[model samples]
Target: MKFGDIIVAMSIIAIVIIIIIPVPKSALDILLSFNISLALLILLISMYIEDSLQISIFPSLLLITTLFRLSLNISTTRYILSEADAGKVIEAFGEFVIRGNAVVGFIIFLIIVIIQFIVITKGAERVAEVAARFTLDAMPGKQMAIDADLNSGLISEEEARQRRKEIQREADFYGAMDGASKFVKGDAIASIVITIINIAAGFTIGIIINNMSFLEALNKYVLLTVGDGLVSQIPALLISTATGIVVTRAASDTNMGNDVLKQLFAYHRVMFIIGSVLLVLGLLTPLPNIPYIILSSSFFLIGYQIHSRLKISTEEEKEIAEEAEVEEVKSPENVMSLLKVEDIELEFGYGIIPLADANQGGDLLDRIVMIRRQIALELGIIVPMVRLRDNIQLNPNEYVVKIKGIEISKGEVLFDHYLAMNPGTAEGDIEGVETTEPAFGLPAKWITEEEREKAEVLGYTVVDPPSVISTHLTEIIKRHAHELLNRQDVKKLIDNVKEEHPALVDEVVPNVLSIGEIQKVLANLLKENISIRDMVTILETLADNAPITRDPDILTEHVRQSMSRYITKKYTQGNKINVITLDGELEQLIMESINQTETGTHLTLDPNTIQRILNSLSMNVEKFTSIGEQPIVLTAPIVRIYFKRITEHAIKDLIVLSYNELEPSVEIQSLGMVTLK
Candidate 1:
């Protein structure tokens, strides 16, 4: 081991040896002095530490110090009983400090024991017990808060883990302190008992074995006994007081000394009142006039100094604030700073801040991180970091989700309540503030926490405010995932694919198609709620088809057909897929309207025909919704994109897929045909 570790181990071993063997008077004196010095050092260190956990080793230290003192007491008692003299340290305390009076020395030692045991040690033990209990009880809530922060992206996983470790250390420290306080109490009792035994037994030894007179025995033995008690009790008192200080310490950046001065002297008015009271007391009392005058004068002067310092400090703060404002206005960088925008941003009103703030126990940042990860896994698109900001201009309960500086979705949430939604089969209506679910626009009600369990029992889905906001954010990002897929994102996907499928990437990217072309295809897939995670299939399909047609639209269609199994699995319900299709005549009309040119294919259908087709599709979509089925329109490969474009605004949740995109293993169950009257 290291030198310091060796020294500590040897010292502890020596303490055990001291208990078993008698030490010489000189060695006893040195150890006694060291004991007092060490106790004082511990007290000073405890006073300076800002947090109790800063000195987490204090419990073990308390145990060691208590043992050391007890060992010294035993060693000194041996010498006093055997040789009728403990040491010079004990003799000096007996003769000079207590003036050779055994009764007075005994009384002083008793008083120290009472104070240490009855007052300081008892209070500290109780406080440590309560602290440990409360810390343990609050651990689950604290851990949940940490998880929320981790999910919200406010802190990284490593930071959250460190915070959790600190919390555990805090609980362990208090629990250890609770047990260690018993050591101090037991040591105090041992000191008192040892003193009584030494006095009683030493007198017998002095008279019977040493053949000394009764008066001589009384003087020699009692002095030695009382002296030993005072020596041991002084150090024990100091340590008990130190233990109290350590356990009661609060966590702060400032030390005990700074906190005392700042908090105790914060107000000059209190000092001034105290000074005035002292002045009045001095005038009315019959005590020594000069001493009173000096004391009162000192208070007045100190109060005035504090008042003047406070005034100067206030003025300096105002000056600093004004200077900051002036600098902010004068600097051109402040204006330029506003020009830069985050890729994805979540702006919440003042009331919704608690949902995002880690300090307030909101886990919105952590939820956003999870949302990003979920999107990346499901859509194969690495979502950009979502920046959370507060906007006071909006209503308190409102929040807006933005993409590339544009507001894509906005919603409202109640922070102190839960949202209860009927799972479509509730027996009766619940009393609550009616509102729409922000995520899906389904009818919901804001209910108090007390009603959450009841709502759950009634088969109503209950969600907290943070979950609501997070869900809304998740849905909005999924809907706009295509918009977030830029050239840089495409490059990242390519690099990631390069690790496992380097040849496939090389064949398609820069060789068959550029990054821009790939971005368009990926964006097209994302817009249709299709996962681009199957990059091998996507790239291979593009590599085969790009030679014949350099069109992104046609290339995307080809990629979709290759990913038929994936698309089909999503729309499939158990063994069959229910779908709406166009009649043969309607399909022919759409095909006839397609005008191929050098630029691309264009639809030249009449407005009346488009209107009739939209109306028919809308009716079918509504019919699917009433039956609780998502409407998926099956069409010819040439018209799927065109049909989707025409009906996107009219039917937001409509899914248009080409016949080529259907898996052969899945059976298609056609619901109806969308034919014009």
Candidate 2:
């Protein structure tokens, strides 16, 4: 039976004493409590003995308690039942067991108190340990997910690596904090308070049912129970319940959706409702037998309905949130807009930035914005973007600045100007060459045999489509001028080659000589009838042999140039490059290389290997009779012009190149000397 039922039953027993034995309320209250206590004690003892002795004592215990109660006359039992004292006993007993849950509540309180006392007295170090344990339990696969993202192109390889690291790091950090913080500021506090209150309430409730049976002191605000040294103070119970519920509601809200808090909040809700109704109904109800059973069933149904209602309300809230999110996506501007401002620190010029403009008043975020922009203008940055919070951010590895000062966030392209010019300039920037494509408006043209011949005859650096002296010299300068123009490096390099191939040196020098020697050498030494076109080209070939670029950059000699040359020859299929469909002279050259390949060619004609694949529509040819003209680029959809670099010593390496690269690659492949590192 519930505490309320027990209280009501006890009241009926009180009236039984009043009629059959004729005693005062206080004496009757003691007699009834003693009877119930003895009954409970006997029930527990019986269960224990029967389990050990192999005999059932349940019936005997029940009969003994029943016979004692049977001694009361029916008229007296009905009188006490009318007084609501029976309700109080039944209600109190049920409350003490169910709502009060004295056993569980006691243990929970002890644990919380002990933990809190330890935490307060010493420290809370194990909190992080506890949190880490939970985080470990929640960890997903360490690297495979990120690798899949990278391999499938969901992210770049670098980004996938970053993402994997980020997830694992975040989970670990969050787990540690979660486990530790939950108990410190969450359920542990509530458990200790609830336990003390409920235990005291139960005692007061037991005594109150005893007093309320007297009928005289039945006032709402008065003490309802009077035992040996205890009394159920109705006013105190009400005050405690009200305070506890409000605090509980707030605490529960705090813990909601929080992994740690959710567990704690549940325990609080379960205990609170039972404890409250038990104490109040026990000594108050005036109903007899029918009311007790009906109220018990009603409480059970209501509790069920309350649980359902909370769940439905939570679901509705989630639906409303989802709807709001859908509305936000329809507006592109809203989608692109940055989240609200957090914190801003402005910088200006090369020194400590001055706070020139002060915001006197405005929203906190607005003031921050005004001050930051004002400072940025002082520094001469044209368009200063507000830095947004970088949460769960992954670094773009493809475009990292040099290693000297690797600030991943600020860099876009891997080329840092400082590093390209003078590497190791500062921390975070690494040393690397930043090669800019000359393909913007026009690529500098190489002087062909006709243009260079014309330029040498005309005595000036000039070129047409077939090429010229000046343009060719500039091309040579670009490749070899990293060392000073007068460095003798190119000359010495050319001299060494000339010892074996004099004609090659003669073809290159007159068009491009060191600082002040170009005109004199050309005029004095018949730099002869050598076509300046072939001359510049030969010099370029020499410069190409120079060790300017080295790995992790490139080195034509780092690998056995002979072996590299061998592969180039071995990979070339037919001494003619083929353009799958285009069988022109250019196409023939490409086919020659493909046919010549003897080593295992890893390049497959798979769908994955093809990008922007199509066929050529028509042939395009541009004729330039003079210099200073644009070379036209013809596009034909049906024409298949793809890159082919037989380097990387691995045919599979072509996977990283772009569509434009294939054309140059095919050209390089024809040389039978190209090597990529």
Candidate 3:
């Protein structure tokens, strides 16, 4: 241990020694003065600390100081009964107060004890108990708030960790204080017992053993006992007051001193009212008018001074604000700052804030973190951090999800109601406000809490407001995953891959294709709902095909075929894959219309033919949807890209796959053939 630790340990040992060993009067006087000084110092420090956690060591300190005071009381009591002199400190206190009246001195000592035990110590103990209970109770909510901030990207991981530590420390501190207050109470009772014993024992020893008279013994012993009690009780009172201050303190940037002044004197009118009350009392009461007159005049003067200072402070603040405005107008950077946009933002109206607030039992932030992880696992894309904020301009029940400053999807949720979606096979109709599900365009209803069990009995999927919004956000992000990917994201992916596949990345990147080209390939795969998580296979496929074609579209097709097993497993059900195919005549016509250029390939099919193809595809897709099967259009490998491009705008959720992208073990169940009449 360091020297400081050694000193603290030795000091505690000394306090224990003081209880068992006799001390000289001079030494006792020095220790008594030191004890008083220590208590005063602690009180001053407590007043200056902004937060109770900042002085977390106070509970332990309280225990040590209490022990120290008790040890001194014991040592002084020993000398008073045996030697008739406790210390100069005690003797001086007795002489200063008792003069010749021991009764007055005893009463004063009793008053100090009563104040410390009944008022300060009791109040502090109560506050500490309440604080500890509430701190423990609020721990879960506080932890959730930290997690929420972390998920919302409002605080970094390090900050979140620090905040969590602070919360735990606060709980521990308050709990310690709750136990430590007992030590003070015990010390108070001990002092009273020790003082009584000192007086009784000293009187017996002096009158019976030393041959002194009863009155003389009483005069000497009573004065010494009262002095010793006064000396101990005064410091005890100070320490108790300090304990109260520390436990009752709130977290703030300002210390207790400044906070008290600011809150107490914030309004000058309070002082004015006090002055008026004092003036009225002085006029009506029978007490001396001079003291009240002086007090009221002081109050009026202080009030005027405070009012003037407030006015000056306001004017200075206005001047500073005006200067800031002028500076902001002149700065070009400030003007340009307005044009900056967030990558992804979730803007909710006022009514939806409670769903995001952790204190109100909202887990939206935690859900957002899960959504990001889910996207990364499903699509192999590290989604940008989503920023959540409140926007009053939108309707109270509405929320908008935006990407790159443009709105992608918007939805409304009733905060107090659950969205109950009817499963197709549900038996009975339930009473609720009819509405459309925000995440999917499914028919749903907003039902009250009491109707939740009834809705479930009817085979409805019940979801809360936060779940509805989060589900919609997750889907929106998945659909726009390609748009969210940038060259930076590709670079990060490559860096991550370098750890495991170093040689693969070093050879392919900047050797055959640039990061931008790789980004395009990833985007292309994401656009088709393909997970690029198998980076090694994708890179190897690109390495093999880069020499054959520099086009990203063609490269993506090559990667897709390589990942055919992964793709087929995702959409395949058991051994059968339901599919829609193009007729041989239509396929031949599409092949003839394909044109290759320096930029890329293009399909030159007539608009009428495209319309006819779309109508037929739509009919088949609807038939597949009605049967609860997702429609996948199967086409020849050569025309797959062209066919997907032609139908993408007209069919939102259509899945177009080439024959080469299917697994060999899978059986293709042809549902229908698309042919123009």
Across 319-377, the per-residue lDDT of candidate 3 in tens digits comes to 99999999988999987988988789999999999888777877788899889899999
Model 3 stretches astray by more than 4 angstroms: 21-25, 141-164, 251-253, 276-285, 347-385, 388-399, 410-422, 426-468, 481-677
Give the count of colliding residue pairs in each prediction. 7, 71, 0
Off by over 4 Å in 2: 1-140, 149-162, 167-677
**Tens digits of lDDT, candidate 2, 1-677:** 55996896786665455456555455545655665555445433422331211222322322333334333222223333334242344334334433434344334435435644444312332443444565476556445444333322346545866776666765544444334333333333433343344434434443476453322323211221121111111212222222222112221223223534345344435644764565356546764645555565565565666577678888999999999889888877794656543121111221111111113221222333343344323221111122222222334312111111223112221211111211212223222333322212122223344344443443333223111211222232222222222324335445665786776566445543342333222121111111121223334443344334312111112222222333334333444232222224433333343331343223333442232121111111112113322212211221212222321122321211212313334442111111110
- Over 385-474, each residue of candidate 1 has an lDDT whose tens digit, in order, gives 777889999899999988999998899888899999998887666778999998889999999988888888888999998899888888
- Candidate 2 total steric clashes: 71
> All candidates: CA RMSD in angstroms?
7.9, 29.9, 7.0
Name model 1 segments beyond 4 Å from true.
Answer: 137-165, 330-340, 343-399, 411-471, 480-677
In terms of lDDT, model 1 sits at 0.86
Q: What lDDT would each prediction earn against the true structure?
A: 0.86, 0.33, 0.90
Q: Could you give the candidate ranking by TM-score, starting with the highest?
A: 3, 1, 2
Model 2, TM vs. native:
0.20
